[model samples]
Target chain A: MAGIQKNISPTHIDILKEVGNIGAGNAATALAQLINKKITMRVPEVNIMSFDEIIDVVGGPENMVAGIYLRFMGGIDGNILFIIPYRNTLNLLDIIFGEKKRDLFCEFDPIERSALAEIGNILAGSYLSAISSLTKMLLKPSVPALAIDMAGAILSVPLTYYGHVGDTALLIDTVFEEGENLIKGHFFLIPDVDGYDNLFLALGGV
Target chain B: MDVVKVGMADLKIVKNPQIITTLGLGSCVGVVLYDPEKKLAGLAHIMLPDSNNSKDNTNKAKFADTAIPYMIDLMLKKGAKKERLISKIAGGAQMFDFKGKSDIMKIGVRNIKAVKENLHKFNINIVAEDVGGNYGRTIEFNTNTGKLTIRSLGKGTKEI
Candidate 1:
C-alpha cells in the first residue's frame, strides 16, 4: 500500500484524469440525451485525500444530495457515486417530467426516485463501458441504488470500503453542467487499492 | 461553548464548556464516552468494525475495536474514571437500500454490532442510542450535560 502511494507519479495522475475525461464525457452525452439539453463538463480532477476532505469536496457533510451508488466488479473493483444537490435533483425532475414544480422541500415520489435511479443506471453504464473499452477490462456494475440524504453519510459508505486498506483514498472526480438551467452534478470514481495496481499496469505503467 | 469537530475516522477528547461533534455519519458510528461528574467527554467517529480486517491499522480511531479502547485510555489519562463513563452512540445507518447481496451493504449493521460488542468488552453501559436506519446523522456530544444531540436531514434533530 505504501509502495503504491509513494509510486503515484504525476503521469499516473494524468492517466487517471484522462480516464475520468473519457468516462464522464460518455456519461455527459447520455445525460444530455436524456434531458434533451446541452451539457458541459469540467476537466476531471484527480485527488488523493483523506476521508474527511472527500466529504468536503461534495459540499460538506451536512449538504443534502441525491446520491446514486453502484459497485463494479470483474476486471476492476471499485465504487461509482453520482451526486446531485437536492435543488438540482428537483430541477432535473422538472426537466425530465416536463413540469415546473420547484418546491424546495418536496418529497420525491416512488416514480421520481425510480426515474433518478434509471438515469444513474444509464450514465454509470456508459461511464463504465468507456473505461472498460479503454483498458480492455470486463467491468460489471451492480444495480444502481439511490439515497437522498446528507453528503457526508452517503460518502461514508464508499470511504469505509477503502478505509480497510488505507486512510486516504484516490478519486477521479468530474463535474457536469447544464447551460441554461445551471444544474450541476458530480461523479466520483474510486477504485479499490488493488484495482489501482491493475489499472496502472493495464495502462502500461511499471 | 466551543465545538471541537471530529472528522471521519478521527477522535477527540474535550473538557467542560466544550462540545465535541462529528458530521455525516452514514455507516460509520460516532461513539461518545462521557463522565458527567468529571465533565469530560471523548468522541470517536469509527469507520470500520475491526482493525484486524485491514492490513494497515495505523489509524486506531478508524475501527470500532481499536477506537473504543484508545479513547478510553485517553479519557482515563485525563482524569475520567472508567466507572463514571457512560456511552451514547449515534450513526451506523444503511444510507442506501441496495438490493445486491454484497457484504458491504450490511456494513452498517456490522458496525453497530461491533460497537456494541466493544463497549460491552469495556463494561461500559450505553445509556442512549439513536442508530440503525436508512439515513445519515450528524452528532454533537456536550461535555457538561452528557447529552448527545443528533441531527438528520428531513428527520429533525433529537437528543439521545
Candidate 2:
C-alpha cells in the first residue's frame, strides 16, 4: 500500500484522470440511452481538492441542488454523488414522467424523488461498471438515496470520511449535458483514503 | 463592512463591525467566539472531531481539537481577552437517515461534542447554539453585537 501520509503524485493523478474519463464517458452514454436523446459530456475534472474548494466546483455550498447518493459496498469503498441544479431536476423529471399535476418546482413528491434516484442509480452504476472492467476490480453499488437541499449539506455527508484522514479529497468531477443544454448535471466520485491505493494498485498504476 | 469568509477546516478572527461567515455546514460545526468588551470575534468551521490519528498534519484548522486553540490564540494576539470570551455555535446536522445507525451518520453529534469539549478545556461558556437536526445551515457572526444568525433552506432564519 502507498503511504497514506504522502500527497498524491503527478503520475497517480494522471492515471486517475484517465480512469475518470473512461468511467464518465460510459455513464454519459448510458444517460443518453435512458432518455433517448443525444447527451454530451465534458472531459472529467480530476484533482485532489479541499472540502471548501469542492463547494465552489458545483456552483457553491449554498446553491440548492438535487443529489443522488450511493455507497460503494465492495472492492473499493467510496461515495458516488449525482448532483443536478434544481431547475435541471425539474426538467429531467418532466422527461421521465412527462407533464403532470405537479404544481411546485422546489418540492418533489415521493414518486418524483424515486424517479430521480433511479436515474442516478443507472448513471452511477454505469460509471462504476466501466471502472471495474478497466481495473479488473469487483465493484458493487448500494441503493441510492436522494436529497434536495443546499449543496454543502448534501456534500458534507460523504465528506466526513475524508475529513478524518486529511483535508484534501480526490474528486473526479464530470459534467453531463443533454439536448442542446436542456439538462446539465455533475457527477462526483470520492473514494476513501484506503480505497485510493487499492484502486490504483488494482489498475496497475502503482 | 467587511465580511470574512471561513471555509471548511478553516478559521478567522475579526474585530468590531466586521462579520465572519461560513456556508453549507451540514453535519459540521461552526464555532463562533466573541469577547464583548473588545468586540472581537473568531469563527472556526471545523469539519471533524479529532486529528489525533490523521497522518496529514498540514491543516490545523480542519479539526475541532486543533482549531479551537488556534483561533483562541489568534484572538488573544488581536487584543481580545480570553476571560471575557463567550461562544455561540451552529450547524451540526444529520443530513440523512438510515435504518441501522453508523458512526459516519452520527458525525453531527460527534462534531457537537468535540466542539463543546474544546470550549470547556478553555473554560469558555457556550451562550447559545442551534444544532442537531436533518438539515444544512449557513451562519454569520457579527463582531460588533456578537449575534450569530443561522439560515437554512425551507426553514426561516434563526438567531442564536
B65-102: candidate 1 lDDT, tens digit per residue: 99999999999999999999999999889988888888
Worst 10 residues of 1 chain A by lDDT: A98-107
Best by lDDT: 1
Q: State interface RMSD in Å for all models.
A: 1.2, 2.8
Off by over 4 Å in 1: A1-4, A100-103
DockQ of model 1, rounded to 2 decimals: 0.81
Q: What TM-score does each of the candidates earn?
A: 0.98, 0.92
CA shift of B101, model 1, Å? 1.6
Clashing pairs in 1: B1-B17
Measured as a fraction from 0 to 1, the native contacts recovered by model 1 come to: 0.83
- What is the lDDT for B51 in model 1? 91
